[model samples]
Target: MDRQPRQSPDFLEALSARSQDIFRRLVERYLETGDPVGSRALSKMLDMQLSPASVRNVMADLEELGLIAAPHTSAGRAPTQEGLRFFVDAMLEVGTMDETERDQIARTVSGGARGGRVEDLLNEASALLSGLSHGAGMVIAAKSDMMLKHVEFVRLDPERAMAILVGQDGQVENRIIDLPPGLTASALTQASNFLARHIVGKTLKEARQSIRRQSERQRAELDEIAQRLVESGLASMIEAETSTPTLIVRGRANLIDDAMASDDLARVRQLFDEIETQKGLLELLDDAETAQGVRIFIGSENKLFSLSGSSVVLSPYKDANDKVIGILGVIGPTRLNYARIVPVVDYTAHVVSRLISKKGEL
Candidate 1:
């Protein structure tokens, strides 16, 4: 049931006020309980006096317009994806978190008055969103722009070695690279020293360019194995940079029911399988964002989100200069409360960007 939504919500304006009111109530109740709303339920929820028969006639018209559908052979109806989209874009009101809630978000991300490393701040924000929203939270962070304090290579085995990169601000990260045949401890030492010489106080991208310019003259300065190790370690560092930003996901259990209801388990399984192959998920984060910063992608017309039957509320967090260095958001079933979660995600991103800006000032 991965149906497509209409391109625009303008058609929603043509519905009579009676039809629109019924549709809104129907969608609201369905989102509230994750179940269909019957005509009797709609009649009670409505402010004006309306008969069940009148509501049923309106529901039939809504069904024909592709706004709502019956999930089973029953009188109850649920909002279609298109219906939800229209309600969000047109009829829904975005709710605001109370002052206490906003303060909690600020304190959680900033680690209480003082800020931590960029990595720690992002992880904290992800956990906070998951706990508050009751959904899996994700953060995609870029490391290419960060300055380096030290970089080293350690041989794990004959065929593999590790590259550990330490940021100037005490952020430590490591990546594994393949070792060339017949290499020795001397080569590892040579590679580590070579990178330390050129990579000090330079970003991975800058270091690569700096080292390559000196390669021809430095060629006679080191053995062939050492040169390869230097290039390999540096390449791995940059390759592990922005294009492969570190993905932090938390509260996956919130999405998986403990009872493991058959239908719920099936959707959870599908979601896990797509996340395990994260290419589509990463791409979705990259493509997610609007002039307003927060963008919502529901099921269908997307990669991981479509197959998982999930929706993502994503926003990009920027650096001191306002460059989009990463993304953060919530992921859960389509039945999530968009009115509530959207504002939380938007505010959390704001807090993260503010903390990063303040960290840069320090």
Candidate 2:
């Protein structure tokens, strides 16, 4: 799906104070109860001395402007997607997490899972977000090239060997390569030592460039066997690193409840299909990386969630150099509690970035 730019909030200037208050309250009530809000119900909540009849007239004006509509043949109203977007952009007051919530996020993302691998930490984060928000949690892992710490080649058979790479972040990866004819144990040692000496602190991309330059110059004083092993080994490792990006999703069960499964099976099925494909979801997150803070995609605002009538709250996390590398977020019904979930998503992104910044130390 094509990405859409965020709508401007200029239209909010047209709404009067009373109209804004009524719209905000109606959206809040619908979000809390998932029910259409009636004029009488709003009259009771507002301190003004307006009667239900007076409120009905205002509701008619709102409906005329396409901000709200009567879902049935009743006086009750529900916010349209446009209305929800307006409320979120103009009137939503983001709340801070309490002590309990702060502790929960810290423990899940960092403290309790101390010294865990980056992948495991991200998995924990997804599960924690799902549990807290009662939604499906997702994380797009950073696929950026890592600083090399160590490299080794172990022989498997006469024609195969395993290239083991250890990054400064304690990330270990292995790639099996088809050996060139008549490669010796001494040649493998020479290749490993050559990589350690030349590229220990450089990123994979930089290391690859350096190796290519050395091979072209033929001035590194290496034997034919050793040079070939270095060429093949580093080429294989670079190919593996540049493969498709990684996506981690947890607590999909949270997306289905007994009530929702029985009442709206079609929507539930569509949600599952979207999650299974994940291409569209990844595209949406890729767009989020351009923005500075948390981004909210409500209902049809994002085509991926259009059919499912769902919403997403996403934020991009950066590395120590402040480069955005990945995204983390949650997905749920459009009526999700934005006041609470927004802070959770924002804070979680902060925690993930902090952990990534300390990767070299670990």
Candidate 3:
């Protein structure tokens, strides 16, 4: 379970100049119109000296190069996944966002900062993203350090006690730890005093390390019962936080538009189902945005999306300390305009990082 994403393959010298031109046209046309590309149409658009028959020959050659496919006998060709990959990797030219779009995105993403909580910011960002992209937008909020605000212990049973930990950031965690065999109310008081002395103003890891060192010193008057309680309680608290997955997604309904009209309707339904079930969207984004940067998963190359005929453009958003907090991205049909959306997603992630930093400063 190495969590890092697999690296992308290096580009090889494969398609010739003419074949590249044909592939680019088919990909561009498919993305723009969501339709197949006929050779006659391409010949007229490119103003090449080739007839329909000659253009068809070149298209066949391009198909042999794994760059194009004819969906039916009489229909025009469409860019295959391999062809789309080639275009995305080398040929596609992304147009710059107009000033209007840039300002709009900035305003939209920053709207959730009224109170400046990370959760609120992420929710606003997800909703704004969905609105902007006309597809699903997702944000995986990263867990931050808990600044301790308070702690209390409740005796749930003679053999169990619950540690209620509250953080300055307004998050709460409750962990149940087994009581020592001979533990009593007096022992609980002594344990709370001993533990609070070590836990306050320190992170869970820091507290654990400090407690471990203190217990190992084995002072003669040390409260053995209290030390064991603190140790078990700390371990349980850490495990509880790690096991909880926090993810936010919006705009799934946006996918049911005309762009997804392929023979894979059932498959699309399954993909939507997966998105709503397990944290599939987060998992896919986590797997792709590996280098602390943006990554594009096109068509069959992404296992989660193989049957869905979809593409995911993901970017890693960082926290104030410059650590990758989570990933953000758009998911849509494979014919999506990767050229346009890649830069948009990348810029959006950057904006999110900047906004988080600003909010932290506040």
Candidate 3 stretches with Cα past 4 Å from truth are 1-16, 72-74, 151-165, 172-201, 210-229, 243-245, 257-260, 273-292
Number of clashing pairs, model 3?
Answer: 0
Clashing pairs in 2: none
- Candidate 2 local lDDT, 1-362, one digit each (tens): 11223675565677777887788889999988878999999989886787988888888888888899887685589998888887788778788888888877987788524764777778888888898888889887656687778888889999988888888767787788878788888877777778887778887779878877764455366678888877777777777775545678777776778226437667767877866776575575567667778888998777777788788888888878888778888988888898888899989988888887886433
- Which prediction has the highest lDDT against the true structure? 1
Q: Which 10-residue window in model 3 sums to the lowest lDDT? A: 1-10
In terms of lDDT, model 1 sits at 0.79
Output the lDDT of residue 147, model 3: 57
Misplaced by over 4 Å in model 1 are 1-6, 112-115, 215-219, 258-262, 289-291
lDDT tens digits, residue span 1-362, model 1: 01123365574567999999999999888878888899998999899899999999999999998989998676699988787778876887778889998998988888832535777788898999899888899887765467888988888999998888888888788788888899999978987888888888889989998888884777667789898877776777677775565778889898886216325687777877777667664565456433346777777746766877788888888778977777898988777798898889999999998888877732
Which stretches in model 2 have alpha-carbon errors above 4 Å?
A: 1-5, 8-13, 72-75, 148-170, 174-202, 215-240, 258-262, 280-286
Candidate 1 vs candidate 2, TM-score winner: 1
Q: What is the C-alpha RMSD of each candidate to the true structure, in Å?
A: 3.6, 4.8, 4.9
Q: Mind giving the per-residue lDDT tens digits that candidate 3 earns over 269-351?
A: 86776665644544653554455556778777767667677787777887688777778788888787766776788778877
* Of candidates 2 and 1, the better by lDDT: 1
Quick one: ranking by lDDT, best first? 1, 2, 3
